[model samples]
Target: MGMLCGMAALSLVLGHADARGDAPPPAKKPRLVRAPAAAQPAPAASPEAGLLRGPATVPAHWSRNHCPDSIPEGAAYYIVVKGDTLWDIARRFLGNPYLWPQIWDKNRCITDAHWIYPGDALIIPEVNVVAPGPGGAGAGTEETPAGGGPTGARGPSTPGQILFPSIEETALQCASYVVDGREDESLRLVGSEQGATKVAFGDRDILYLNKGSNAGVKAGDVYTLHHETYAVKHPDSGKAIGLKIEVTGWVRVILVQENTATVMVEQACADIHLGDYLKPFERVQVPLVVEHSRPTRLTPPSGKVVGTVVDMQDDASIAGDRQIVTLNLGTANGIAPGSLFVLYKVMYPSVPTPRIVLGEAVAVAVRDRTTTVRILNSNDAIMNGDKAELQ
Candidate 1:
């Protein structure tokens, strides 16, 4: 009877606790637990990342549309868009368009200020506003001198800006001599500079000409001197195709007479002699365009190996990197200045295919039947007998 009474009392106590909403502390309300924060993804790398330091950043032009006026600190990047320039990026980010060099120095993919293409993600560093001063905008800045400092005009020359000679300069100064021995009735060297009677002459020497005003030649007229080398023979028939000529030198007429004139040797590729011949000079000029890679979809054009390395510009027997060489192929064979050719050495020309590619060259000057080429690159020493085909 006591046990029953105790159980009844306990039941009554539990029922009262439930009515007061206190059952086992309501399961502790799940402790209102919170979950951990999620991890953020890292930024994607750029295709030109190898050429740069830190992360790739974009120009401020991108922020004009999408970002706030003030950018956060630390590494940033931007996708390149059409019409965006380094100058514009500098002005937008650094508050100075002349400071584009700072961004350029930070990016190696930007080989040229004028050549950045769309889709390139440029790096944007922190704003480093520099006051205009003498000299220029500072190192890595463009040549925009403000106040009294000499701009790049009179300052020390910037390296890499003039590393290679222009095509016009090379053509005028470094063209090879074409040997022309065939007798021409009208064109023949009469005498040396100042009539010194020297057997061989060179640059800056004055010469006496046989034809002047009567032959439509006048003072200040430029002429090319050449000599007949030999007639090129057909490999199959041993028949002569054409007479190959050699360039002797160039002359500028200073004084003119009815049948005689005083000419000055402007440039001499070889020794100017009493028997050299002359014709009106044709100005040759072509801008140098360095190719980073071979053209795609456009395979190298097919052409015959028609020339030999008659001579080297530096008088070296074997030509290598950056050496100048003369080839028999020229405008007459559809070769022009700036034309690229692949050098090859085939033991037997009778074979249908080129045996091996030795190197590459670029034409700096094109004459009637010859061209002056500079070795762009080479694997083997370019010898005199190595053949070259259009690339």
Candidate 2:
């Protein structure tokens, strides 16, 4: 009985010690079982992430809140890349695939729409689009005006409102003639619009000429009207340089006859008389651009002042703004309509400089031996003896 009690007491003591939590940890998994590799963090976004987006996709750079109704003028451009097509480019930039020809027309370098190399920059012209808005129309959604634009911003048209001169106005404003000693020339003004009764004529008047089909005159052909007024004498030499031909008007052949042609006076700067001469008209070159590229002074090859302002349309001794003046230089001296020139006065008799800048002139009509210049602007009065140098 004593031995049994001792064994029970020892077992109870061991159970109490286990309940006190003095146990060892379990063993880890064996070496045969492998673990997974750690996951990598994603790469940072690229700096050009917005630029590389496909053309068909709306650019990420566009503001979501404020889309435009039309592409503003001179706003956008595209750099050509390999495998780019005009169709895709138009759709991407102009928002319409059918407008691909617009792109082709603008980019002259694209000789063939099918073949385009990288690195060519293309201009994206302004285009109208129906931008979605709260009212289904937006800020630039107005209809074009009747006379000018879709926005109705052109207002109304009025007579005499046009400040800039028209082609006919600019052409007919001056006169150009080459006097070659044809006093009894084959072509001459036979009579005025009022039969042979009228002595003088004006613009838009009918006139009779002495030559027609037999002289190879066509119905649409234009002619210049002039008469040798006086002989232009050289200032120093006292010898005759060229004849001073007074340009009276111009005419367009209308009716044809065996030896006569009826013509309408297109313009008459002076009174047109019966004895005025007629010569074939010359077309005007040189575009009337908003700005002309001209040298500050005369350039070489045409450096020297080769001509002088011999006459004025108004018959005034001095010419001011927008006055017409005649120059000795013509097509023979490489002068053309739209040719720029600087008018300067000689302070001293022999010295060309310091050039007294009289003004600037533009050649509106160039003839064989003389040119018609319109004084564009002048700081002072432009005289007849003023010098002209090509720009």
Best by TM-score, which number? 2
**RMSD for each of the candidates:** 32.2, 35.7
Model 1 TM-score on a 0 to 1 scale? 0.45
> Per-residue lDDT for 323 in model 1?
75
Taking the tens digit of each residue's C-alpha lDDT, what string does model 2 give over 1-391?
Answer: 1111111111111113223232211112111111112211211222242122212322333111222223333234565454455555554554434334455555544433444444444555443211111111111101111121111011111222211221233234335444545555579998766876778998788888888899998897778788877676534445455666676767888899998999988777688899788877543322231232333334332333346777776457888776777776666555555556778777896765566666677776766767777776777888877777655
Candidate 2: stretches off by over 4 Å: 1-174, 178-184, 192-196, 217-222, 252-254, 289-307, 330-336, 350-353, 367-369
Pairs of colliding residues, candidate 2: 143-150, 144-149, 144-150, 144-151, 145-149
Error of 2 at 185 (Å): 2.3
Q: Could you tell me how far off, in angstroms, the CA of residue 229 lies in candidate 1 after the best superposition?
A: 3.0
Off by over 4 Å in 1: 1-168, 171-174, 177-185, 193-197, 232-241, 293-318, 323-336, 347-354, 365-372
lDDT, each prediction: 0.52, 0.52
TM-score versus the correct structure, for each prediction: 0.45, 0.48
